[model samples]
Target: MKEIQAVKSSLNAVFAIKDLGQLHFSLGLEIAKTKKGIHVCQRKYALEILADAGMAGAKPVSTPMVKKNEKLFEQVVMHDVSAYRRIIGRLLYLVNTRPDISFIVKCLSQFVQAPTKQHHQAAQGILRYIKSSPAQGIFDPKDTDIQIKAFSDSDWASCILTRRSITGFCIFLGESLISWKTKKQNTVSRSSFEAEYRALAATCCEVQWVTFLLEDLDISVHHININCFKVP
Candidate 1:
């Protein structure tokens, strides 16, 4: 408490300050304090997304994507490019607290420039999935181990349109996930090993950035371990 007061005093010397007390909501993220930890979610934001997509009454689904009928660069064109862009832009922000949809969102993002009916339908599927558990989010345990760890993987030629692989990784601060992404490999890879290596390279860059951010906040990690895994 003394440290916080000292920092507040210093800030007040140069600029105005306001203590909002414990955080509950900011920029669409809802924060709830609990005995176990801090629970973060965007329930309201997710509902807005569903309504915007005209799926508020839609039935919920268990998974974000349907494996058997997934859309992959379908040729059927959607004339309303702006609509597609708007929905995807919303989903990208929604991923702030919903990493489970990250991969499917990444896949749908690739077609924003030239979205098809199938692409839009696939996006709606994601909204239906969101309806299943709108309050689901990350739980950051208080006073837990602060170790840093990361795991990365790549799917060999996951994108049928470009034959490019999808690389994904998640970084954890102890038991809490802090950073993650699923993106298409910038360059084509010759084999699975090469693809996996590229994914690790991307993960390294993210870890470096996160480390620097933690240092800025004066939170230092003594050790970091990286693990590579096969994408199932």
Candidate 2:
């Protein structure tokens, strides 16, 4: 409060600033605080993205990406690195609110540097998924518990381009997600278990850091749910 007041006072000393209590909105996020809890939404931002992507009339989807749809370069490379990067960047920001797209976005982000025609198609698949879930976001209520939990998953040799397995994980606090990632492993695994284990290690580190953050808030997060599951 001192820091805030000091800044406000300093500004007031020069420009006659008025004190406003509680922020209702800032940046691109819509801020709403209620007796039940706080609700954060980017309705305007989501609509804008949908309009920008030409998906304003897009219907909702149950799943964003599919394994069968993930294809590699049979011939032409998209050759448009700039366009790929822009789409992925927008997708990354949307991940702030859309947890479901996190895995697919992470997968498509790999080819942002030298996006082939195949990569562009893969990227389009993700945008289509986003079109389906324009209204999604992280929900934190005042009454939720602090039980931090994580589920790790791995798909061995999932990438046809680099022959790399894609690893995925999600961490939750009580019932709400705190962090998640879906990424390709740097090394090639000899077997499925090796790929799954490395993915688990990545998630373990994430959960550890998350635990420390919670501890700083005087919250004790149990580590009992740091389990790994494999998908063929």
Candidate 3:
């Protein structure tokens, strides 16, 4: 636990907050320590989302998106701009607890410029799915000190307008998920390799920062960088 102690020391040293000796919550993510396996969920925020989004009574969905729904997020987002933006904004926050939907959420996030009825429907569907499985969350055991490996992927020319690809990445510590993200490239690329290369550059920067953070914690990683996968 030297890594944990070192990181804690760094954080405490920088923030000047008195160390409590245990972590229950940080960065909006809740933590529960125990003798048995630990579970992490957005229990408190999930309820709030259900109530506020008018989805408490909606039926549960097995998947984030329905099958055969070929519409682009921008097309669906053109109907109700205001409501779509509001719900999507909330979903962005909810992703902290629901990484499973990270990719879908990032895709839908693009249509805030002009959300349509289809967008509202799709967003509502996601909320219903969450309502049905509010207790779903990441699980990290109380044991283990192994380095976890992950993969990042991106599909080029995915955006109809910009032809920019979508980038996805996941980070793990032993068996616990420490970070994950999927996003659209800011610039257009002529080929899949270019897109993947740009994504690699961006992810590498994150890798360096995370590695430094781990170093401060005294945790060691035999392999620090995650594998990046690409497709045209």
Per lDDT, the best of the predicted structures is 1
Model 3, residue 92: distance off in Å is: 1.0
Give the clashing residue pairs of candidate 1, or none: none
Q: Give, for candidate 3, the lowest lDDT window spanning 10 residues.
A: 68-77
TM-score of each: 0.91, 0.80, 0.79
Can you write out model 1's per-residue Cα lDDT over 95-174, one digit (the tens) per residue?
Answer: 99999999989888978888898888888899999999999999999877778899999998877778899899999998
What's the residue-level lDDT of 72 in candidate 1? 59
lDDT of 1: 0.90
Model 3 spans with C-alpha error above 4 angstroms: 1-29, 67-70, 73-81, 230-232
The TM-score ranking, best first, is 1, 2, 3
lDDT of 1 at 89: 97
Off by over 4 Å in 2: 1-24, 58-61, 79-82, 116-118, 230-232
Report how far residue 147 has shifted in candidate 3, in Å: 2.0
Q: How many backbone clashes does candidate 1 have?
A: 0
> What TM value does model 1 have?
0.91
Which tens-of-lDDT digit does each residue in 1-232 have in candidate 3?
Answer: 9997898889887787676766776655676767855777777777777788777888888888774244664343353377778788988988987998887777778677876677678888888888878878888887866675666777788776777888777877777888888888888888888888877777777777777888898977776547887453
